[model samples]
Target: MPTFTALTTLADGEKARALAESMEEMDPTPDGVGVFEMEDGSGLWEVGGYFTEAPDEVALSLLAAAYGARPFAVSELPDTDWVAKVRRELVPVQAGRFFVYGSHDADKVPEDCVPLLIEAAMAFGTGHHGTTLGCLRALDRLMNAGIEARNVADIGCGTAVLAMAAAHVWPRPVLASDIDPVAVEVAEANAAVNGLSEKVICVEAAGFDHPTLAAAAPFDLVFANILKGPLIDLAPSMAESTAKGGHVILSGLLVEQAEEVIAVYSAAGYSLAHREDIVDWSTLTMRRE
Candidate 1:
């Protein structure tokens, strides 16, 4: 059955409470319908879900009339039988000497990663995204040069998937950070799932400028898969934290934006070593001078 969800937000809690009283529950035809809200100190936001085969036109009109500013999204729940079909067709990726498994093939990851399912959620890094694959390929190329490190860090570590991949290949202590706490939890879980929790440290931090990160300075390698604006902003800090012969892998920029990001690092004593492009985003690898 198709499900409809309407999102609403009130500038204040009083409006939220008042609006809640107006919701209807008469001709309910599905498993259930409900309202969910979360308050983040900024304001209260709610999503009202209605599960009905027939459109609740009258009720919807009433809510729309009272609160026309509310937005809605409609989505259908997929059948369980199609899970395999969906997985196979939507996600398959390979980069460098690594094969990331988010594929529909139940066992998409090769024997080496046989233990890791590589379940592809909406998480940040799956190596399925072009940027992530670009990073992987860059890492593999670096590997060919007999690169190994005692310390590594991944910035904007969404889901920490790449960090996990790194831990699997190298025994180094990997530092992973994200500003989002939810992402920190997910990354930690992913590391543990892949038996890398002990080797990877997940923290809620932003930028390479933090005191703790600065104290741990001069990592052998750093992986940052964030967009150009921030990359440009943090170039000096990132370069400063890199060991003299270490490298920085950067992503989250369009092919056109690479030069701008590269210019920032290059000006700070880093030399460009490699570049990878997928779709519109490009990833660049640089070695500190």
Candidate 2:
């Protein structure tokens, strides 16, 4: 069974979303449709759809033109075991004392390093992306600096990797939450696989909205590895949820967007303590004032 994909970009997010919705009505309707803002600071939104059969290119072109977007680029993707391929290609990643790898790479885990097992099927926060890796490194640095957090929360935790990392270093239970239920499920599964199921609690919540998160307020350390817009929107809530003098680790921002994010966090009474740029992404560690 072959899969097909059609992708296009536009400057307007609303238009991109509308286009994605419209793609559902097309012949050979897409199995999935997604609209997301480009994280490159380009102010563009990408609209994409996955189809079981080849999509009509002429219809896609017409739809793109209607929305004033770039012509849709359609591609046929041959059926392949993507999870197996990811397992083979994604080697273990070492960020400070934390080592992230899949079970296939179990032999590569070092004796002295803290190991986090994230399977290739759940690939979002497998320490392969710069944002996740940056957060782990930031946590490692904080630990090295004699900062021990009693309560920690991993906001927008994709695979609970950050939460597990925090639990590994600290004795307290860590809270991990994601807006998507599937991610929360994946996070819980990852926690169990890493043998930190009791230490890391996975919940489905938008930001700090759940009862579990509310009861665990004033976190000593918080990790928000989501994109720029959500990070900005989360500043006030994050500040309110964090304890005074607590630490916040943020990533999923472009180098150019870091200063704006810093300014927002500063207004929320946070000062940048450290910043690292890994390729095009910028990660910042801040202390709440």
Candidate 3:
């Protein structure tokens, strides 16, 4: 079956959400509607709808005008085997000491690297994206420096790959938390697949808001591969949750925005230790003072 999508962006988040809500009531109503803030620090909200049938473009245009948004770009998605495509295209990624691969590429893992199994169809942070890859490399650097972390936390952990990596190197339980319940579930499943189920504890929470993460506060190492805004918002909490002299590895930022994030964390009592840039993304490793 063919699928269709209609998407647009608006500067106002409330208006974008209202537009998405209205799209749910349209004829040939969307199977799903979503509103999300753009992660690039654009201050724009994206509103989108997915449909089994083609959406009415005129109606979408009118709705966009009503919401003061750009015209919706409607497109029909091809009926393709996404999983097969992913399996064929998503090759194994090697970041320093870690190797992230799907089960289909199980035989490709090199003997010298630590293996982390995350299916291509699973949640984000598969180590394919630059942000996740940078974080993995940052962790590898810390390990090479002989840093021993007794407690670690992976905030906004999509598939718990970072948490699992920490568990693989350190003989300690690592806390992994995400705001999305589905992501938390995927994280748990990935942990099990990596045989780190006991070592990587997954939870559903935003930032450090959960009791389990709070109780496990003062982490020796922290990973937050989320976007720029959330990273800024998380600095104070990150400072509080991280132990003095502990390290926090952060990514999901454009190269231009890395300076801004560095400033925020610096104000929160963190000093930049190392930075690596992959393509257009930047990953920062900072030490809590």
lDDT of 2 by residue, 1-289 (tens): 9999999999998899999988999998999999999876688999999999989998999999999999998999988999988988889999999999988989989999999998989887788888898999999999999999999999999999999999998999999999999899999999998899999999899999999999999998999999999999999999999999999999989888999999999999999999999988889999999
Alpha-carbon deviation at 277 in model 3, angstroms: 0.5
Q: Work out candidate 3's RMSD over C-alphas.
A: 1.5
- Top-scoring candidate (lDDT): 2
lDDT of 3 by residue, 108-204 (tens): 9999999999887783678889999999999999989999899999999988999999999999899999998989999999998888888999999
**Residue pair clashes in candidate 2:** none
The TM-scores of all predictions, comma-separated, are 0.69, 0.96, 0.95
lDDT per residue (tens digit) for residues 1-289 in model 1: 4554444554544555555555545354434444434423343556455554644556655654565425444455543444455455556566766766653454555665323335545344777677888888888888888998678899998877667767778877788988778888888888776678798888888887456577788898999998776787788778778999999999977787788888889898899999989987788999999
Candidate 3 stretches with Cα past 4 Å from truth are 39-42
Worst 10 residues of 3 by lDDT: 118-127
Relative to the true structure, how large is the alpha-carbon lDDT of every model?
A: 0.71, 0.94, 0.92
Q: What is the TM-score of candidate 1?
A: 0.69
lDDT for 121 (candidate 1): 53
User: In order, what is each prediction's RMSD in angstroms?
Assistant: 7.7, 1.4, 1.5
